[model samples]
Target: MGAPVEIRGLSYAYGSGDLARPVLREVGLAVGPGEIVLLTGPSGSGKTTLLTLIGALRAMQAGSCRVLGQELAGAKEAQRVLLRRRIGFIFQQHNLLGFLTARQNVAMALELDPGTDEAGRLARAGRMLEAVGLGDRTESKPAQLSGGQRQRVAVARALAGDPGLILADEPTAALDRQSGGEVVRLLRELAKQRGVPILLVTHDPRILDIADRIVAMEDGRILPTEKAEPAPAA
Candidate 1:
């Protein structure tokens, strides 16, 4: 198979005609299996927009984007849904249902795959929570956990489904130095072990060391390579 994500000349905009605001311009990118790629840029640079398109969360507006071996342009909603199922997503907000326990939130993701029985789903959820250092908090509601712990639950939820690709947007934005480091460490370890490629968007310099490659963006276009240059703060 090819790279988990491959793009060529991708572009997207909001509005139309003279009122249109372009967010991405002729973007091209790829994320390899088991690779950790960081998308770094200032605010309004279209990093999140690119991530949404690759995750099938948004319809393709223009250009070619193939994610997890599926072409996104012109893909039907059903096809996009299936593609989304194969990808994991993490965001700035933990987005855990306040009433649900960590394991329950993770199991919710398993529901997308009908192949697993309810019991199996729960069991896998427990294991994944443990993997993310949340074994004791499996039954704890999101409200009961600390910010870092809740984010860890979010990570478990994203990985429990055994997705082929992981797209994270500012996952560490709300975290402290120690918490952010722990979160990215877990993600890197899991990605390497499972051979799942990760496309992470972050302006956090503390976690840049986790990336195999850092692609910087500015003004809706990818910046030319400059070795070890840091991304601007959001």
Candidate 2:
């Protein structure tokens, strides 16, 4: 298969005419399978805008954005919706339901998969929670867990559907240093294990070690990327 994500001469703007404010300018990027790419820059550099375009959360405005081998430049809303289901998304907030247990929150994501029965969904959700080191806390509610644990549940929920690509936006911004470290490490491990390509936007320098490449953005354009040294053997 081709790279999960590819972009060329991509640009995006908001408003109309004189009110229009461009957020991405001639951006080009690609995320290969099994690769972990970190997008870093100052606020309003367009990191999140790029993620949204790649995730199909926003309609493409200019240039080509191919995701999972499908071009998005002129795709319909229905197509965008379909493309979205194939992508896993994580954000700064956990966005978990306070009423649901950890396992239930993850199982909810699987409900979108038409092939799985209720029992099968729960089983897979439990397994994913376990993979995130939350097996013992699967029965706990969001309020009953720490911020890190809630974020772990969110991660499990995102990965439960076996998505082709993962897009994360400032996933570590809300946690303590230790919690953020643990969360990003878990994400790195899971993405590597599943051979899933991840495009993560972050401002945290502490977790840069987890990336294979770091792409910087400035004033809506991408700067040259720097390859990160391979992680030391465990």
Predictions: Cα RMSD each:
3.4, 0.9
> Candidate 1 — which residues are off by over 4 angstroms?
226-234
lDDT of 1: 0.91
Off by over 4 Å in 2: none
Q: Highest lDDT: which candidate?
A: 2
> What lDDT tens digits, residue by residue, belong to model 2 across residues 103-142?
9999999887889999999999999999999999999999
- For candidate 1, what's the RMSD? 3.4
Q: Residue 111 error for model 2, in Å? A: 0.9
Q: State each model's CA lDDT, in order.
A: 0.91, 0.93
Candidate 2 displacement at residue 108 in angstroms? 0.7
Model 1 C-alpha lDDT per residue in residues 109-206, reported as the tens digit of each score: 99867689989999999999999999999999988998899999999989988899999999999999989888999998898889999999999989
